[model samples]
Target: MSTNDDGIEYVYTRFITRNGKRIYHQKGGLYKFPKRSKKSKS
Candidate 1:
């Protein structure tokens, strides 16, 4: 859940505890997938 100086959206979603546990986490400022490109100009 970090971004480089370039700002190329990314994520690090999930962590496991030392004693065998699953931790769910979400960061802020993350972007969703972009829309599909247009196939036809007309």
Candidate 2:
């Protein structure tokens, strides 16, 4: 796991299949999706 200058962190998720194989899934990287923020009525 590592973080970039842009404050984006990179992490790997481990998963196992039926065949007993280890797979790493990448989460949170350079290409991060924008999150929607809820607006409050004033």
Candidate 3:
């Protein structure tokens, strides 16, 4: 996981296949989804 100066957060996950092959998955972009706040008003 990482974040840039522009506050753009990036996340990546690595997976190993049964054949010993590596796969990478990534998400996040300039238009990433908004994060939910933990503090909610009743």
Candidate 4:
């Protein structure tokens, strides 16, 4: 979902919840989607 939206489909490992926000996890560390949308603008 977020992975594909954020354009990190391959590198994405999984996602987590912290501070009421979705935190994506990868091999390097973690990150949050720049902006959430029902449909990605790009």
Give the best candidate by lDDT. 4
**Using TM-score as the measure, which candidate wins?**
2
> In model 2, what is the error at residue 6, expressed in angstroms?
0.6
- Listed in order, each prediction's TM-score against the native is 0.23, 0.30, 0.28, 0.29
lDDT of 2 by residue, 1-42 (tens): 554455454444444233577544555223342223333334
Model 4 scores a C-alpha lDDT of: 0.51
RMSD (CA, Å), each prediction: 10.0, 9.4, 9.4, 7.4
Model 4: per-residue lDDT, tens digit, 6-30? 5443333476666999766565444
Give lDDT tens digits, candidate 3, residues 2-30.
54444444444444233577544465233
User: Model 3: how large is the Cα RMSD against the reference?
Assistant: 9.4
The runs of at least 3 residues in candidate 3 whose Cα sits more than 4 Å from the true structure, single-residue gaps closed, are: 13-42
| Regions of model 2 farther than 4 Å from truth | 14-42
Q: Model 4, which residues run further than 4 Å from truth?
A: 1-13, 28-42
Error of 3 at 10 (Å): 0.7
Give the CA lDDT, 0 to 100, for residue 24 in model 3.
48
